[model samples]
Target: MRFNRGRRSFLLGTAATFVADFVLLVPGLLSGRSVRAAGQPVSADSTVITVDSTVIDVSQGAASGALALVTGTTFNTSGTPEQGVRVRALDPATRNEFARVFSDANGQYSLNLDPGIYEIRANKSGWGAISIAVTAGAGATHIVDFGNGAPPPPPQEGTGLVTGTTFNASGTPEQGVRVRALDPATRNEFARVFSDANGQYSLDLDPGIYEIRANKSGWGATSLGVTVVAGATHTVDFGSGTAPPPPPPQETALLTGTTFNASGALEEAVRVRALDPATRDEFARVFSDANGQYSLDLDPGTYTIRANKPGWGAISMAVTVVAGEIRILDISP
Candidate 1:
């Protein structure tokens, strides 16, 4: 699928806030000291320094120089710092990634870059990704953060939850399948998501009748209708129990013959052409060898076979070939 610049920007904005409550940025020059948020429990893998309240001062780090500094923290919906999220800096025009780093045990990362416009992305397996656009100037510092908040909360008043698993025809869980909620009356899609590794997906929607559809490439889609109620949960599953049959193998046929003159003498170096009679489009061409023998391999079809020589004139005949056939015809031209 392809998206224009405007559409790409819209999608990035929507996904950034999809589940995350909000992104926080504390941009300023901090003392070289790294400080953690008071009373926050430290994970076993956490580093000694954590930046929760202020941005890290690049001037004190190895990146100190004329290069611009980009820094941020990764956190969960509840504002708890998350470790090991991968952050990337990409060229805005070409969308080519130039730099990447993983959040430290303190859920913090810093990147130094040349002055330019960039698309910053944060991602991790199993969790959705978020991205933001930024402009970095020489000798400047910018802060950006990312996270898709926790799972959807219980349906509030006037809203309900839908959850399900997508399966293949053979009854095995199918990951990466797209699941969508559509308005029953208008048939317009309202929300969509890709199933996770375990084939699980969920959507929070307003109370109404909806068509829940599951789709994946190479497989027929499945859908179900449900009447949603406020503050309730619904479960739905998709797929047929039987598997689809395998595709047929491809096969070819061969056409071989000898060329002869009108006087019944074997003629060598005669040009043999095979063409589609209806369109007169040539498919194969070859010259008779010293022994007056030539061959053409083609798919099953009807073709116009023509043999010609400078002084021997030409002969045209309609020949039919079927799969696995080795047809032989003598041409006297």
Candidate 2:
């Protein structure tokens, strides 16, 4: 797998906190302190493992384009325990996964994922996080570590912390609203917030100019522009667009000739769906009509026609076309 291993640049003097008052601290566990110059020692029973929380700054194709890797090492213990570590990035209404890394002799692993809320789990290490939500800006890095070790507590002095809440235009609380606060100069989404039942959210960001937007459900979303002076709180809200239109029908690739099982038998009742590649959304779904044949009229673009049968395998092929374009596809498993 292609893993983007970018060294973290900035470290948050304080350890990671999944939420308020809930620190990722274990009573007897003191894994992180200082092991800069050389590699640290790995004991058969490692309770002290250093951690690093890196804030990523990125810009590219989609919001899900910026990907990074998270990793660390533990000693070669006599009995290998499944760390049970799971890592994923958080979007407004969804959680996307990069991958899960299990410890080995070197006690190391990593995940390739984009920016957003990242929930990590280490059952064997007594570590659990709902989602270490992150809003990394392009080219910027924030370090967050949790394992056998961690950093010290946050200092009283403000390192440029800015905050605020999100609400709909009607002043109603918007849950799962995708709020992005961007730093005008760097164009980096410094801090991100989501409205609670009270239409509230907050972020710890550096002092500067920001452009915040609100995404509410059912109603048209709004973008509220504001500036976050040194250490201050700013409130903003907008109506999310009308309930997103109903999801279109599922899509299936069009089949002209015979679709067969590995044994040259006609494949029947294969589930197929037509897709709108541009949005990756489905349009319509159906069984391969009686003759083991099917047709799909996809929204002009690129599509991967898929064919599947219970006792047989599945096959898919990519087809590209312009508006009102039609293509034929066949499958054999």
Candidate 3:
């Protein structure tokens, strides 16, 4: 349509203003700036805008093809959860790192990785690093756990270690001593180790009360009681010097006795008995032969002697026996 100068100029000015607004908004949109609609600025709430040209896979939750998802957890050598451990997915063929993440508080981590052979490594401070080879499939989920290159930990949790030193009664470090950790409740030796040349020893053990026994040849054995806590190293010391006192001299006293009837003649087929003066406990018993004589070895102690026969009355007397000495006693019934 033909228009007058005034109307055409006005329309031209309005079109130019609209074009300028479009140009300014274009840069803002690319820079993540919010847009206003209907003359009011949009709130901070975001709206997801999808383009028709972009295709999404309903089943895979990605485009027609995407990288695989890898999830796993990191643990210490003792199998305790290791949070904040750094995990990396490496392509061994190219030695390139494709993805990296830090483990969560639960020691869990996830990564979107391209389908290929990868070397997954996990590392943390004070822990041995671990790496594992895996073949990831596209659109597939895989798991790879790490335990600092150590064997799987025992099922029991929160276990700890015990360490100690062995010393002689003279306060000198004792080497080659055998240290044993015994479970008090079960009375079983759960763990054992030897003291090194420096008299240092260690044992990984469970939490509980234990008796640590240290022993060696020519040295007396010593034991100490300890209570172990989870994830802790309990230290103990043993001064096990000084040889045990010599065993009391073996009993070697000889007691010879004769049983006789009221006539004071040798009584054949008679019974002779020796009893301890204290506790009234029977100490020894012997029977006289056809000659009515019996002999017995006993510790050096005082004892009561008695003579007995089925038809004869019982006779009793007090006798003292001495070590390495032979004593003769006569019993009459």
Among these predicted structures, which one has the highest lDDT? 1
What is the full ranking by lDDT, best candidate first? 1, 3, 2
Which of the two candidates, 2 or 3, achieves a greater TM-score against the reference? 2
What TM-score would every model get versus the actual structure?
A: 0.35, 0.28, 0.28
* Number of the top-ranking candidate, with TM-score as the measure: 1
User: Which sections of candidate 2 miss by over 4 Å?
Assistant: 1-164, 185-188, 237-333
Candidate 2 residue lDDT tens string, 1-333: 011122322232333311000011243222221111123322222222233332211111122235444444322123232243333334433443333333444444343344444433322333322222344443334443333233211211233332333334454444455566664334456545443333334444454444454444553334333434444433333332222111212332222334666877656567564455566565434344223444443344576666676877777666674543334466787
Candidate 3 segments whose C-alpha is farther than 4 A from its true place: 1-65, 148-333
Q: What is the lDDT of candidate 2?
A: 0.38
**Model 3, 92-119: lDDT tens per residue?**
4454676556676777766656676666
Candidate 1's TM-score: 0.35
Q: What's the lDDT for candidate 3?
A: 0.53
Ranking by TM-score: 1, 2, 3
The root-mean-square deviation over C-alpha atoms between each candidate and the true structure, in angstroms, is: 21.6, 19.9, 30.6
